[model samples]
Target: MALRESPESPTPRRPVSPAPVELASPAPTRHGTAALVSAAAGVLLAVLWSFEFVDSVIGDTVANNLLGHDAKATAIGGTGAGLLFAFVSGFAGTFTACNIAMVASVGPLSQAGASNRLRHHLRSLLRPVGWLALGMVAVSATYGAVGVLIGDGLPQLSTDTVGGMPVRLIQSSVVFGVIGLVLALLGLSALGLVPDVFARRPVARVVLIGALIGGFLIGRPYPLFNKLFHWAVETGNPVYGAAAFTLQSLGNIVIVTLLFVVVVLVTRGGFLRWMTDPARSALVTGTLLVALGVFTVVYWDLRVPSIFGVGWFPTMPYN
Candidate 1:
């Protein structure tokens, strides 16, 4: 009897842990490294977007003192163009960096998980990466185009002699906000992060709230999008006005960052998991896309004069 009781089926040997996934163990492909670096830069810009108070004050000062009044609005228009340039360029860089990072992280893991055919696994990754890259480019380009439209609209808005620094700052902010979103989306896709379902609703609400706050700070009438343009008319020093606009621009950056962070964190478990899980991930991605589109449309048409008012922050020498 004692002999019969001996083995106890050896506890049915616990299943062995799955083999570790192989990342891109070989030297990173040029494309993959580029993606990683670009994503890092994108992250940095996202952080810069968070500080509203300081930027606004500086903007106000620049608008009032540098560009002076009437020409201020035109300068703001130009600033928006500047931002569009910065954003699109940055977005391109980030996408490349992120793609590299994904290969470095996932390629190796896949190899470790299954040693058979490494090249095949990596080749499969290319499609998703391409899709992500294309998305990034499209979104950023759209944002820049919208900025152009808004910049063109500046002259008709108001006859005030305020600074252009404020206007420029505002235009820059709008471009940055939209461009930031594109970068964020690409980063998420490259990292194989979650799609964003769990946090989509909350993140969307936050974006909306942030937009409202930015509008209020600038003295735009609440509610209707067009009503907010009047805030471009400043009451105090040109610097103060520019500073206000800068701060308002910063507010938008902050909102985008918050949403980006939420998506990144949720997907941190694994980019593939997020991508594969349509229900959760798709919802998040879809919401972000929708939010971005709406913001672009509304913000672009809101007011052309306020951007020129940014001139109050930076006075024009020729004037």
Candidate 2:
């Protein structure tokens, strides 16, 4: 009986199911990398426009039309008229080379928190703008007081030329170069390529940006600002100069405010919510900072130097 059990009892094995194959969806497009690339594209656009023809086309035509060429500052000269002129001129010249970059400021305001309640929502929208003005007023007003007190003594306001290059332009090169570098770094910070100083320090970053925009006057070569400056000096009232410059900076930011209003209205208050998304916020902020930063540097440092034979950059046929 024991010997009978040996015949056909082969070992039975359980069927092994193949491990589930994971079909990984393609990786999502990285917002950070995309943002960085966008910044580079913006710089390329600016570089392409570095030719003299861009001056003829965009600068002369669009900027001149907006800035109202031949409208003398002296013509706009009463006490009220002068201040009015300063503001209006600033508003008109928003598209000018020195100031257009300021549009990038909207990027920082994107950090503002959103509210569903209408009254609170509007306040939230405007709060950042006010913070920006705090820093702007400090710089613009202080510079105005100092600028008028000095009255053409600053090398930036000088009318002389060296090696066929305007001395004021040289000053422009230096000032803009530094600011441009700062802006580029800010962009990197936004993209998290650099230390994310701005993440925990929103107010400070905004204030810094506001200060930079306010400082634009320090390097301005605009004919209107020059005229206003001379008129300010003629009056010999630093208070008047400070008031005028402060109004000017206010006018510049007014356009930004209006654009914000339009955007919020158009999006039905959705843009603010859109900005809450970390990836989108980083994309927007990083792109703008890098673009304008690089433009400021390349235009003032490279393009301008090339104009006076200091170095060479590519020029278009129309240029």
Candidate 3:
């Protein structure tokens, strides 16, 4: 207790002000720019896939491998044949522009997946898929039934053309346009650039995505689907249509589902946790949504329209 010790009660130190959060963060800018570029790349990829060289080669090749060369003839044998065709065709379409966007679901699925003991993880895998299938089945069954009743009256099955553009292609443009916008917006939302509509509504989101997958049939122009449509009409049975379409939707999801399972099994659910982690979830989910979403929009709307001179998409030399 020296007198010196009491002489100067040290002046209270000023609390340091936390470093200024740059009011204008570069983060948003970087994200926005990356998003734009990703979107552009999506469009380009859509164009590439649209070109005859790529589309005909990949889509047709896949279909041939899956259903043999008789895509149209193969479905004509009877109800069993038609149903089988519906499924095989849907499955084969996994790479086509109309259906490829379905792949975007992988992002949400990955984000939703949770890790646990392998037994629990394996069992848990199907829950999200079941939810997805529920959504898909509803749309597909309804559309299939109604499509039979409506026949060519449905724009998706129209034989008519407008302004020299096949009405079927026009339907593709409209349907995929909406779906793509939805996916892209979802990506933006995940990236924190928009309201998080599905943050608390994860189940609904999955269902909606499933519904979108089902909706793919609404715009699908594959030969087998077209064949199935006519078959359902000829049979005069909505039940047939509904059943076949449900199967088709289920088939459409089979490969992607398997891939999801493989990822979970191989990684022991770690990939999903890594993806869904708060830090990386948004980035991964957003990128997938934006890319696939933009691909859907461009492949259908822009690329298809270009054929009618509504716009121009680059053509590869081989085509």
Clash list (residue pairs), candidate 3: none
- Per TM-score, the best of the predicted structures is 3
Candidates' TM-scores? Answer: 0.25, 0.82, 0.87
- What residue pairs are clashing in model 2? none
Query: Candidate 1: worst 10 consecutive residues by lDDT?
Result: 94-103
Model 3: how far is 234 from its true place, Å?
1.7
Residue ranges of candidate 3 with Cα displaced over 4 Å: 1-27, 51-56, 64-69, 115-119
Compose the digit string of candidate 2's lDDT tens values, residues 188-279: 78877768877877768788888988988887776767767777777889998899999888877888888987897788778877887776
Question: Using lDDT as the measure, which candidate wins?
Answer: 3
Q: CA shift at 238, candidate 1, in angstroms?
A: 39
lDDT (tens digit, per residue) of candidate 3 on 1-319: 5555454688678999999776886656766776787798798787566444334565456666876665754546788877877787777667777778788788777665644334678666887788889999999999989887887678876789898998988888888899899989988887778888887666677788899999988888766567777888778788999988998898889889999889877987777667656646667777778989998887788778987988897766544
Report RMSD (Å) for each prediction in the order shown: 17.2, 5.9, 4.2
The clash count of every prediction, one per candidate, is 77, 0, 0
Rank the candidate models, highest lDDT first: 3, 2, 1
In candidate 1, position 58 carries an lDDT of 37
